[model samples]
Target chain A: MKTLIVVSHPEFQDSITQAFLKTSQAGLDDVTWHCLDEIYGSDPIDIQAERELLNGADRIIFQFPLYWYSAPASLKIWEDDVLSRAYTYASEEGHLKDKELGIVTSVGYPKSAFAAGASQSFSISQIMIPYEALAKQAGMKFMKPLVIAQFGYSTDEEKSQLLVDYQMYLTAKYPFSFNERETWMIQQLKKLASGNMKNHQQELDLIIQELETGQDDLNDLKEQINLIRNKEED
Target chain B: MKTLIVVSHPEFQDSITQAFLKTSQAGLDDVTWHCLDEIYGSDPIDIQAERELLNGADRIIFQFPLYWYSAPASLKIWEDDVLSRAYTYASEEGHLKDKELGIVTSVGYPKSAFAAGASQSFSISQIMIPYEALAKQAGMKFMKPLVIAQFGYSTDEEKSQLLVDYQMYLTAKYPFSFNERETWMIQQLKKLASGNMKNHQQELDLIIQELETGQDDLNDLKEQINLIRNKEED
Candidate 1:
């Protein structure tokens, strides 16, 4: 599937979180990153061109930092000028039918800050319901939002995990599962081992072994649970 | 209390809903109407001036036509530039503390279209939660939104009612109630009758009479219910 990420940030180059997220998907072939601020610098949006881009993508992701509990102004402008026209076309021509609509947002505050009696008083998911409603109106499937809370303070390990998760979020098939993610990782390691990267062989082997051990541990836990159920029945 | 209305519409002059709503509050002494599109006009926002306007108002109203389940892009841009800076000031100086935040939105579709299993699939209240969240963050009291659904197709009676409601929404004290609204309307009719509006004397008297009749009927119903309970006890 061709995935298009429409990024909206007031100062894209200055955003550390956005920069790190962009680097994670740098080598992907089927993914296209379109930055709104850069594309329409002081110019009116070309609605026809935007519609063409949307037509070519199977999965469309709206990526931004949460500003005032919603997307940046540029994205809203794009929706008003471009997406409004696109919706009209979709209604008549079924252009966006079966397309996947996804949101990948980064928030400055911790996730826990968003809840009843909390600082934000509403979850990120609640704030994002309008987008889900928009997706339904356009006959598109709304994907679960990928929320990165406190992006500026994320550890390297957390970012590494985000790299893998975000890539899968963009390209993985429908109803993505944990098992599919594990399989994909293993396949990637095997491909790397077969290539002429002899210097990294030892590191690759250790990583593969760890994955295998983790899988065995999960299977053992499942067996233990089954045995407990059998004993209870007897 | 001084009320500042920040109106956001891409095509403000061409919008019937916005025009009608604008007329509702015309000639009001303490109300300031700032139309974003007209103020900006392809130019960058003057953040300093916007901040001054926000500081001067006791109640700040965001009035707009719902585009893609949210406000127009201009509003988002305003939030990012002006509001973000104002929030910093609010944190330190408590500038927005004790202020009121209100939303007056016009939707293209009917109110019923926004519900579970409906075309929009999310109520206006749900969609406007972000604004409510923003108010909480800034230490402002969030007012219940004034939603105008299917604005173009509203009946004349509905439009007349909206005119009164919208005015009270802008100027009324905190915890605005039905009784306060009715009292205000009666006072206005009495004032009009006392003024040199001889032609409107009969019409104003008729309206005041109807309002008094409604109030009397409500009081009589309450008294009858109390009497029935006393008889039942006997």
Candidate 2:
């Protein structure tokens, strides 16, 4: 699908790293990069201009650093304006219902700091609920977030890996579905132990038993995860 | 202190309840309520104008309806534009170093869904880490969020009380600092279960025994409660 990247970094000119990524990203065909601040400047958004942009693109990716636990101010403003207009348009007569929504957020903290036992209290995706919800309201596919953690501490190799991972995230067909994730995890775990399910076989057997004996709960979990995963798409 | 309320509801007009709250919020003094989409009309923000707004205010409040798990789109835009500018400004010279930030959100889901193991795996504030981090980066105090749960389903009484509580939160002199919250909770709990320790000898002795033992994780519990309460504020 054709994609539009709504990049929201404030000082794009001074951002050597992000500018570098953008240069590579720009090289890709079938995608357009819009630096929101440059487009909007000081005036309010022209509803028509935004509607046109939304209508033209099949996927819209929100690109920014995860400031505070959310987006920068202009991105928020863009949501309040652009997305609302889309909703209004849809309510009147559906428009842009099949488009996809995504996020590319750069974070400063180490990945582990976001765990339950850590000082920060929640993982990165948990901190990204608001964007997930936005995708739902606007009727777009909520693509998994492309996260770059410890941006300040990254080694050159790590940074390069992050860039490649980000590109993969933006360009690839989604990795797996919510229902399929548990199975994927189980398979990966088995693969890691020399393709021997025997080591973790008891745990897998127990999980299978649980899935079979408690079909209702497992189904509920699957349904719930599906809802979360499909929110933006619906 | 003076406060700025940046409300991010997409359709403030059709929704009578939040709209009513907005109307009520209008007459309050020392608070600037920027109903973002209403003002910006999908246009970009004027950086100088916003800087002036922030420079003028003592506290900044991001007010919005909880969509899925976040503030509206425009609020994100605002953060991206305004705060990133402030970040660059601080990097180059310095600005917005001492301001305070808060969130006041209205959620459609009831409070039950936010618990651990609940359908949604995180609370409102847990989902809003980007903002908290931003406050830290901006060198601003991140106050407790003000949340109204199951807003559309809230009873008349619930909303009535919420209005008063919200007003108090906006004007209160006591900022919800982590340092003082545990002490505050103990004091509040004491008000409910026991007489003043100095006045009641036996109760005081029992409480003092527990206090000496230090068994209850009052501090950690207080932090969690504070997080939820603070989410309400934002």
Candidate 3:
């Protein structure tokens, strides 16, 4: 599926986290990275062009840093201008109907600080109601948000896992069941084995083989459990 | 109490609701009506001057029509440019500490549409978490929001009640206990009697006298109930 990442950062060049995220998806196919401030740059947004971008994407991602517990004004300006009621309402034209809407927000505060009694005193889910409501009005599926909290404090291993998670969020199927993840992982490994990692092709192939064998074993175990339960019922 | 109403409406001139609200608060004392779009039209916000206005007010009201379940972009721009972290954090300078933050938002939908299973499926309180969280960070008291819904559908009596409620929201004491509302009403009526409404002076005076008598009788009844409770304890 084609994914569009609509990024809004006032100081995009100065942000290391943004840079890392930009680079992470650079090699991914069918993913469009559209940065608002970079393109508009204080000019009025071209509503037709913006709507075209939304129309082309199967999955739309609003990616930004959490400014004042919401997106920066540029994104809001875009929302106010481009998302016309006639085009957005489910009972009307509904251009965004049945599409997936996702949010990727990075915050400076620790994840633990977002709770009823914590320093932030509000969960990310609570703060994202506006977007969810928008999704509802447009008849879009609201995907679970990917909150990158205190990314600077994350360890190298954690960052590696985040990279995987971020890529999966963009392209992985809905619900992201374990089997779906395994299939996506194997495909990525096969691409890597044949592409830039030609020297490590043998090792990557072995790993892919092991994953496929594990999947087979899992299916066999499920069948055995179902058969035993059926016999007990009889 | 001094009130600074920072209003942000892109189409302020065309909005009948905004016009009605503006006229409602026209003769009120110690209330500064600051319209952001009119004052700073296409101009950058003067951060220091905006901070000074906020600093001067005992109560700060963010008045706007709800666009896409949040305030318009201009208000968010003002917030990002004006409320710098150094001056806003309660642990730091905390310039807004102990002040009250209020929201005055007009919505197009019916009020009943903002419940879990309703068409909107999100309460105004849930949608306003960002502003509430901002108040929490600034150590300000977040007042209950004044939501004006379907103003065009309101009857003349409903509109009159809205005027009084809006005035009370801006000027009345916090918690707005019945006694406090009564005192505020008496004060406002007295002001009207002495000022522009002097043509109905006798009638207004009689009404004021009747209200006072009713208040005194209620107080006496409360005292009698307390005395009886004390005797029961004995």
Candidate 4:
């Protein structure tokens, strides 16, 4: 799938994390990196061309540092000038649909502060909801964001490791999971073997395992839960 | 409560919603509306003064059109240039703590497109999370945003109404329910009250009635839900 990585640091030459990330993505076959500030440095933004690029891409990644907790301005201008409701929705020109969109962000804050009593008040998922909403309007799939927090403070080694991890995260089918119950369910299901499904620990495990491995005469997850509950009572 | 409203439209004089809002807010006792684009029209940003202005405020309102999914470039430059980690967060100097930060935005898209099946992928909240997180790191409160959708497409009468509503929204003494859930709950509460909350529904009585006339109760808005559920039941 062709991916468009829109790098949005005003001064990429001075930005360590975002600049490095852009460089790392170089040589990838299907990925095209667009530096927003550089492109719009002199004249008005080329709206028609931007529309075409997004239209052509399979996935669009907004790659940038977290500036005051939002993206740089070029992204905003691009959105206002390029993605028109008249064209994208009301008229016969709904060019963006079923395409995937995600953010590859590198922030300079520590991960610890993104919680109550920490420096920041909310979590990553909470803050990024606005972007998700934007994607929904454009009829694009909201892929999981690839975040590199505390980039400024992170050691070179740590930053390098995160860069590798971020690259892997991009190609992964799904990377983000919000909500406590969903996270809990995912954490439980990860332990079950895809190699051989057997010997579930309890009713909960049996249901989970059956749902995951398609065992125990349960075609669907809800049916598996019922079967496990029935087995537990018997 | 000193409020610094940073209005960042490229051409503020030509703007109806922003100009009206600014004019309305101009005479308020503790409100200072700084037109960002005007401040840095021909030069690089004056980072020192911007920092001082932010330092001076109890609340910082980032006012702009919801370009792409964020603010204009002047804001991005102002944010990046002024809110450096060396000075704003990690310095021996003071941090931006105990302060309130929020957004006042206008976008061209209808709010419906910000939903799951709509063309836009992420909600406005999703795109704005990074800012909330930034506010958190600087030890500031990230308040719920004031969004005006389909800005240019609206009628002149509608635009005037939006200006007044937006004016009221900015100067509002909203109690602290900072995260997206509370914001979302409040938004949904506003939603349950009116079909047009996305585009219209500005007055305090309607909004306050939805919130049940208090703040802390919004912390656990199950009461608001029950209140709505009861209304729906009726």
What is the C-alpha lDDT profile of model 4 across B1-234, one tens digit per residue? 788898888878898767667776765567888998887784778888888888888888998877656676677767776877766663334457887887888876788766555566556776677677667567677788878887768888987677555554555555533543345446545644556444455564467565554546654697778889999999
Residue-by-residue lDDT tens digits, candidate 1, B20-55: 878888856699999999899778899989989989
lDDT of 1 at B118: 77
Provide i-RMS per model in Å: 0.8, 4.4, 0.6, 3.6
Each predicted complex: what DockQ? 0.84, 0.26, 0.86, 0.35
Best by lDDT: 3
What is the lDDT for B91 in model 3? Answer: 91
Q: Which stretches of model 3 miss by more than 4 angstroms?
A: A223-234, B223-234
lDDT of 3 by residue, B58-146 (tens): 99999999999899999999998999889999999999999999999999999999989898889999999999999999999999999
RMSD of every prediction:
3.7, 16.1, 1.7, 13.6
lDDT of 2 by residue, A1-234 (tens): 677888887676786657766865764557788888788765677777887887788878888876657666667667656665435333434466767788887766677888766645567777777666555445557887877776767788987777656555555456545445445444434444444557777776667655444555778888999999899688
TM-score of every model versus the real structure: 0.88, 0.54, 0.96, 0.62
Q: Which stretches of candidate 1 lie over 4 Å from their true place?
A: A85-90, A194-196, A202-234, B85-90, B202-234
How large a fraction of the reference contact set does each model reproduce?
0.97, 0.61, 0.82, 0.79
Q: How far off is model 3, as Cα RMSD? A: 1.7
Candidate scoring better on TM-score of 1 and 2: 1
For candidate 3, the share of real interface contacts preserved is 0.82
Compose the digit string of candidate 3's lDDT tens values, residues A1-234. 999999999998898888989998999999999999999988999999999999999999999999889999999999999999998888799999999999999999988899999999999999999999999999999998999988889899989998998999999897788888998888889989989998998999999999999988988999999999999999
Q: What is the lDDT of residue B65 in candidate 2?
A: 76
Cα distance off (Å), candidate 4, residue A181: 25
For model 3 the interface RMSD, in Å, equals 0.6
